[model samples]
Target: MPTGLLILLYLVAALLPLGLAWAQGLTPRPLVDELASGAGILALTVILAEFLLLGRYRFVARRLGTDIVMRMHQLLARGAAILALVHPFLYTTRRAPAPDWDSHRQFFVTADFSALWPGIIAWLLLPALVLMAIGRSTLGFRYETWRMLHGLGAALIAGFAVLHALRAGRYSADPAMSIVWLALLGIALFALAYVYVLTPLVQLRRPWRVSAVTPVALKTWEVSLRPARNFPFRYHAGQFAWLNIGTNPFGLWENPFSISSAPSAGPELRFLIKELGDFTDTIGQIKPGCRAYLDGPHGHLSVTGHSAPGIALIAGGVGIAPMLATLRELHARNDPRPTALIYGNRTEEQIACRAELESIASEHGTRLTHVLSAPPKDWHGATGMVSPDLLRAHFSDPEHKRWLYVLCGPAPMLEAVEDALIELGIPSRNILSERFSYD
Candidate 1:
């Protein structure tokens, strides 16, 4: 319903002015038309961008593979950027030389700098965002660094844009226009509040203490946290949480780690994190008394969403995180659903939680298939990655649509598996892939 409304709103927004121009039979000023259209487009773009960045909305997008939503967002951002560039050029008579940062800084410090002042700052901040979005591969910027800068840069942009709009005399002059602008600003603030302020604040007021931080390997650790007080979040077997370390609410260092423990294990939340980057590597170092803020129970790549009589589970390396939850749920429910897991790793030594997986499989009557890409000479399991032929030969009724494939792994592996599945005549919708970003 919201999706339909957005489309309808966009159509109306796009056509309303043209209709007005035709109905009034007045000479339409091209610059005015452009400016108006640009404003509308900019407003919509900023709203969607803000929405996608919000925790709840972002979770929904992740679950639904909200690519269409993102496409709309990308389109709007590009259009807004173009319109912003053209807006100044088109209104040449009204356009003045852009003041340098030094000159503008004093005006910005003054809270009364008009609605337009905020927008001017937003305009200045947008280039960095646009560049960063395209600068992932280049610019010598790692994903983590890019993400941090993006968040900081976006906040500044939104703040500045709001200020600019409020200060700009045209929109600011009318009370109703101001109200509408304020309403949009309020919604943005609400999202930010829910993610950063309200959620964390509530959690902190009623804390969830760190239970343990145990090392699984040289670089991987399992950090468990359980509620010290009443907690409302009831996560599915495979969902994750955004853990904020060091009592820093605005730190924005939230990372999605799969709940390594089963939902049947009660309120105790577990996360197995590999020390690959700056965040996970140091997770073991966090002291027991240190306060941690959590903001999730997100990601819907769980048994709850899929209801097939049988299941094909695929994982690579640490991608087995969600499968832990899925297996647990299956075991707890006594779901006689025959499930097969093709867990892939580089070597036998790196096969994490192997015993736990085998035990669960035994208890639930689920079969475990180990695929070692680069195993030792004595390795007895499948010698290579999961291929269509291997799957077809090993599994019963392999070609049926009644079986759902839950794939979670590195992007390259997942892509290959998806391609292989398609080649074997399985429908794309029957295959679900979980995006496990170490970001």
Candidate 2:
């Protein structure tokens, strides 16, 4: 689905309960009490929507991009936590049960433990979940482990929160509101099950086995996977997949990696992985013929359908993975358009597949520029960074602004390069980029 439509759906879902409650036409309450209810319900709805933005749903990720989806998940989660924590204090209604004559709960609010316990549990859980997510990188937990726990924690909070709403909320007293909340909760839980159970079960039939694991550069390796059978996986250039090696289809050790090989190169998939800890640090230990599973062909960064006059690919470090795929595909398809690859690394040793990149340049007429931050004293190529001045020197012509530019690199380089590209009179649509790191 398109991004705007998805957002519209979210707005409708979030406000449905409030609309239904207003339709109930119950007695009026204090403005602060109504505001408290609105905040609580909105927070719950946002939490439910977070499940759909789980960063694995292709319908959302393909349109919004995984980086945007993940960023949205984190940001909205913090917002929801704040709302959940403060809604209770915003209430001005009396802390007492509904009177014998007041069946609509207009003037009274339940302070009973039976109705408040679930809300209390959810209130405490939300902040902890947000904190864990914020500090996850520093917590020394495996990505897979943290992801599994995060899902479980969110599910727990959703269940408790909705239960409390149905039991205690003045607006949720309406049957329509109850149904909406329950249905939304069901959808959220099913999303979790789909990622954990259904997707893995489907992958069981189309499994792969590692064919090779060779060191490509400093602390980086090229791992190859060939289908055990005639697996028919098709992905565009500059896309990625979740790779689980030597683990069951249901295992949590899977991690996303950009496809380094072109799709035209048969059933084998290639990935250029740099050691950054976690599963990557153990890449060397993964031998050939180990069972593997892939859950993707995700990401929206591609140049397949563009009719640009030329293409410029800027890559830093392992961000070259998808660019390699794009270069190989363009070469295989015998594209006539001119192409340039600007690859940057700390040293010459950090450059991966130099021979192949050069061979592409020689055979396919690609212009290859290598930039080194820590160059050797005798370095003949471009020294220093792939800076704005270098970009200006190469793309000095007015026609270069119309060329399609694809950039993948560290966040800082990407931002600097993007700003420079826009400054060079390139339209925003003419430049394509996805940050390897969202934060």
Candidate 3:
């Protein structure tokens, strides 16, 4: 589906309950009371919808890009938390039982402890959940532990929010709206089950084994996987996958890595992993022939169907993973398009797959430019960062502006390159980038 249509569908799903509630024609309450109720209802719906935006759903990720989906997930979670926190305080109505004439309970908020307690609990937990997620990196917990906690906490919050809505909400008493809430809750739970249970079960039958793990560059390893059975995994050139090595498929001990090898290169999948976190730092220690599981072919970094006359690959450090995939695929296909690669690293030692890059440049006719921030005294390549000055040196030609620009790097570098490209009159859509960290 088109990205716009997917977004439209999401908005409809999130706001459907509100529309149904309004259609019920409940007696009008004070403006503040309505606002409070609306806030809570919207928050609940958005939280439920977040399950689909967690970057696990291939349909959503393939259409909207995993980076974009994850960023949206983080931002929307904060927005939902804020709305949920303000839900109770925005009420102007007194916390009392409905009078005889007010059968719909529109004139006053619920005083029943059973109905309000769930909302209170959910309201209190929402902020804590958001804070934990925001401080995940600094909390000093393992990534897997943090992920498990985050999932469980989100599930609890969704359950509590749903219970509160069903028992205490004014319009929730309507049969249609009640069913809507139940359906939404069911969908959220199913999403969790799909990710944790169903996917793992499926992976068990199509397991992969680590074929090789060799150091490629400074603190970076090239990990290769081949199917344990006669299974073939299909993927686009620049996509990524969640790789689990020497672990059960059901565990949370996996990390996302770009498929540095091209699909045309056959069933064996390769990942260029850098030493970053707990899982990645141990890549070199993982022995070959270990059991592994892959869950992906995610991201939207591919240059497959682009119609640009040329391809410009700009990468920094290990960000060259996807670019390598694209370049390899292009070479394998004997693609005749003009290609240029501007790869930047901190030092000569940090440049991954240097020989392969040089070979591609020499044999495949790709214009390769290597940039080093901290080069040795004898280094002869371009010096300094992948700044606008460096970009202008290679990409200043008018024809280059119309070429497809693909970038992957640290957030600062990606942002700087994107800004410089836009400043140089390259259309925003022509520049594609994916961040290494969603946070």
TM-score against truth, every candidate: 0.78, 0.96, 0.97
User: Candidates ranked by TM-score, best first?
Assistant: 3, 2, 1
Residue range 340-365, candidate 3, lDDT tens digits: 99999999999999999999999899
Better structure of 1 and 3 per lDDT: 3
The regions of model 3 sitting more than 4 angstroms off are: 436-439
What would the per-residue lDDT of candidate 2 be over residues 1-439, giving only the tens digit for each residue? 7779988987888777777878888877888888898899999999988898878899888888887788888889999999889899998878898888978887888988999999999999999999988888888888988988898899999999999999998889778889999999999999999999999999999999999999989999999999998858999999999999999989899999999999998888999999999889999999998999999989888998899999999999999999999999999999999999999999999999999999999999999999999999999999888899999988879989889999998999999999998888889898888864545
Q: What is the lDDT of residue 26 in candidate 1?
A: 31
Candidate order by lDDT, highest to lowest? 2, 3, 1
Error of 1 at 123 (Å): 2.9
Q: By lDDT, is 1 or 2 better?
A: 2
RMSD of each: 6.4, 1.5, 1.3
Model 2: CA > 4 A from native: none
Pick the winner on TM-score between candidates 1 and 2.
Answer: 2
lDDT of 3: 0.90
lDDT of 1 at 124: 64
- Please give, for residues 56-142, the per-residue lDDT of candidate 1 as tens digits: 564345545433344555555666565555543444233333346523221222234453465666666676676666656567775
Q: For each candidate in the order shown, give its overall lDDT on alpha carbons.
A: 0.65, 0.91, 0.90
